[model samples]
Target: MNAFEINGLSKVYENGNRALNDVSLTVPKGSFYALLGPNGAGKSTMINILADTVRPSSGTVSLLGHDLFNERNWCKRRMGVVPQEIAFDPFFTPREVLRFTSGLFGCKPDEAWLDELLDRLELTVHAGKKARQLSGGMRRRLLVAQALVHRPELVILDEPTAGVDVELRRKLWDFMRELNDAGTTILLTTHYLDEAEELCDHVAIIDHGALLTAQPMRALMRDIASSYLWLNYGQAVTLTDADHDALAGLEPRSSDEGVCLKLGRSENGDSTFHQTYQAAVARFGPPLDAGVRSEDLEDVFLRLTRRAGGDDAAAECKS
Candidate 1:
């Protein structure tokens, strides 16, 4: 069964702003899924709808095979959401917070699991400290612990590592990986594309309140055949007229290493890298080193969003 099945999910604000538009997506069970978008791209709206904090203008959502609207309590109990905003009772200690959260979920406090969570999140030393006394990173850790206190089946983390230090972020991801390995479904949204690229197996990108694409991470990466090659001659190399002619079609720009050549796959099914490298080597007389920078999530995101936006604009003009 899928972790979440969202069908034609659309959200419109009272001000007539459409947050999400006809977005349909399925998050596979036990998979690390990433829901990515730019600022005001309806990511937060969709997430809040899943958490039941925001009501959608239209569309249906299912959580773990159950109709979310019909079985709100049942679904809520099985889902743990870490919202972007951090809010807590200042007087409550981390221990109290987790205990209270467990009670809210109709679960008796699991002391052993609680201890393990605190230790794993590095919150044991501050377990007794009031929420107001903890630093930003520590408070974020507390939020994560609270979310996992009842060991929910589906976890939605929205920018869980935002404002967290590097060391703490590493620890947090490690803990999350452990949870995922133990058969928990995780849905993550973050501005950090590298994190999504590295941690998530499946990715969905939305822009202008529309779902652009949703596919396996590997498949998405493989579809992007464009790449840039960086060559290093160990020193500056002047581009002669011959070198310019050979690299005419390729977008060559000077780099610290030597130069960078933008390459796109040709229709003849020739390896662009081989052709470009040969042309550079023929003139530059063999570089000290060479590296190919393949298209990553960031490149894909920018290209899709810009292209989609242009298409929408053109459609409006024609209409």
Candidate 2:
């Protein structure tokens, strides 16, 4: 089942700005998906379209089997969103906020259910605090809690952990994971690639209002196929002629941590970490120490977005 099905979604503001261009995506039900893009990559525009807060130029959007344009009310009722900015009134208490939000969907306050949400999000202690009075982290948690007041099937989080403490961020993601495990779909967008890598099951990269790639995290990362081999020669020594040639093009960096060589992942690369360490030994010979670090989500993100943006910029500049 798809929580969201969008095709050919495009939005062009009257100011001659194209917020989205031919964007298409499908978010699976009960999956934690990450929608990543650079600043002004049309993420906010896309989110607004999904939430029905903004209209599209040409496209179709469906939410949990409900046509967003035709069955708008049903679609809106089945999804929740935690926006990047704080959207509540400062004077309102957490309890009051949830009460008002749920009421929007014609849901009367159920004390037990409300309490459960507050507790699950660890907002019980600050339930009575005004939004202005709560700490940033507390306010962020309250934002998420209110989004769940109506028990929506899909939850969209835009930078949910921004400015949050590490411990609190971990707790928040843990709750999000639990919600996903229990069948709620989670769609996240954030500048933090590490966060997406840590929590998302699938990832979609969009740039210049266009979709770059959408695939399971592991599958997408497999394309990188690169790692770093850190080596220690025991004592400071110059590279032998053979050593220089063998390590050529590795962009090796020297530091106290030893010589770090950028390694291109071979098609026949080792299948396991232990095997990788052994392979490093075979390539670099014995050293006082050696380590391997693979390319992470950040690496992939930078490469794809930069390439896409560069190409788009050149074309736009030509005219």
Candidate 3:
């Protein structure tokens, strides 16, 4: 059975902004799913609806077979959410904060579990420090721990690693993987496409309050089928319109020192594009240095968003 399911979920704010438009998706039990999109793509709105922080304008949400809107307590007990914003009482220590949060959920303090959480999150030594005294990264870690204090079955992390240091980010990824491996369902909304590519098993990309696509990470990446060729040279090279037209399947654009060729979906791997790019470099000799590289999730994201037009809100959500 799916851990969480949303059907025809739509949310329109009081200001007449359609935050989410008929967004529907399901997350299987114990699966790691990433909801990716630019700002104003309705990521946070969807999450808020799931967390019961906001009510949807239309549609339903079912978590573990229970209707979320109606069965608020039951759903709240089973799901935990780490929001994008870091919010906590500045005066409380990490342990004190978590203890208070757990009590609010009617959960008794589990010192052992709490200690283990802090240890894993690298906040053990800082547990005694006030929330205001912790560094930005430490505060982020504390937010994650606070969500897990009740040991909920499903956890939603909204930009959990944003503004965090590299080491802390890596540690959080590892912790999340461990949770998923232990049968906890994880739903992540992140601006970092690379993080989504590395951690999520399934992905759903949204744009302008609409669902663009939902599939396994591998399948989504495969469907894009695009690559980038970066050309570097000792001296600047000028190309005529005819020269650009010669690389028909490739979209060529000028860079600071050299040109960049963006290979289309139908184009094959480095072999064909590499040969053509090399030929172009050879023809333009003296100054051109060429390199062909496969595209990653970021490229796929850009292409998808661009295809949807430059929706500024969606773009802002991405960061």
Candidate 4:
């Protein structure tokens, strides 16, 4: 069964900003899903609606076979959320916070499970410290611990690493990966596209409150026909107006090693690429070598979301 099945979900604010516009999407069970969009793209609105914090204007939402609203308790019990902002009480210690959250969720306090979470999340050392006294990364981990205290089947993380340091981010990723591998469904929203690409099995791109495409990570990369060719030049190259026009969309930029040019054979053929390379060599002398790489998720994301400000498309999920 799908972890989340949202159909024609729409949300309009009091000021009439339609945050979600008849959006329909399904998140597969036991997958790490990335819900991506720009600011005000209805990502937060959708997550809030799932968390039952924000009411949608119209549509249906089902989580883990429980129709949202009608079986509120069941659905709520099956989902956990790490919000973009810190929502913990300043006075409560990490242990107290977890106890309170589990109680609020109507779950019996499992001391063993709580202790395990504290140790794994690296909050054991600061478990007794007041939340406000902890470091930023520790506090973030505390939020994660709080979310998992009740052992929800679905966890939604929104920018969980926003202010976290590099080491903590890696640690959190490892923890999340382990949880996902253990059959937990995770939905993550973050501006860090690289992280999403590295960790998520599936991706949904949305903009202007509409879902542009949802598919397996590899399929999205395949949809884009472009690649990059990095030219390692021994010296600098000068470009005339004509040379620039011949290499139009490539937007060749210089790097420490050399220059990088965008290449797409389907749009313009191999002849264009060779001509550009020759022009660079003639102008700057011989190039050390060239490296080629396929386009990545960030490229696909920018194209879809930017175009979705007024247009859209549908892509099948390759589950």
TM-score leader: 1
For 1-319, candidate 3 gives per-residue lDDT tens digits of 9998889999999999999999889888998999999988999999998889899999999999999989999989998999988888999999999999999888999999999999999999999898999988789889899999999999999999888889888988998999999999999999888889999999888999999888888988776645556677643447688867776655555555666666443344324565656655765553445565666777677768785453322222210
Worst 10 residues of 3 by lDDT: 310-319
Tell me each candidate's TM-score: 0.87, 0.83, 0.85, 0.83
lDDT of 1 by residue, 1-319 (tens): 9999999999889899999998999999999999999898999999999999998888899998899998999999999999999989999999999999999999999999999999999999999999999998888888899999989999999999998998989888998898999999999999888989999999999999999999999999878535677788765556667666878977666664587677667798665988888887776778778877766687677777784452222111110
Question: Best to worst by lDDT, what's the order?
Answer: 1, 3, 4, 2
Runs in model 3 deviating more than 4 A are 230-233, 260-271, 274-288, 307-319
Compose the digit string of candidate 2's lDDT tens values, residues 46-130. 8888878899999999888889989977877888888888777899988998889889977898889899888877888888888
What tens-digit string does per-residue lDDT give for candidate 4 at 86-203? 8779999999999989998998889999999998888898989999999887888888998898988999998899888888788889989999999999999999999999999999
The TM-score of candidate 2 is: 0.83
User: lDDT of each prediction vs. the true structure?
Assistant: 0.86, 0.79, 0.82, 0.82
Candidate 3: residue pairs that collide = 38-314, 38-317, 38-318, 39-313, 39-314, 39-316, 39-317, 39-318
Answer with 3 or 4, whichever has the higher lDDT.
3
lDDT winner among the candidates?
1
Provide the lowest-lDDT 10-residue window in model 1.
310-319
Q: How well does candidate 3 match the true structure, expressed as C-alpha RMSD? A: 4.5
Q: Please identify model 4 stretches exceeding 4 Å from their true place.
A: 232-286, 307-319
Please give the lDDT score for candidate 1: 0.86
Identify the superior model by TM-score, candidate 2 or candidate 4: 2
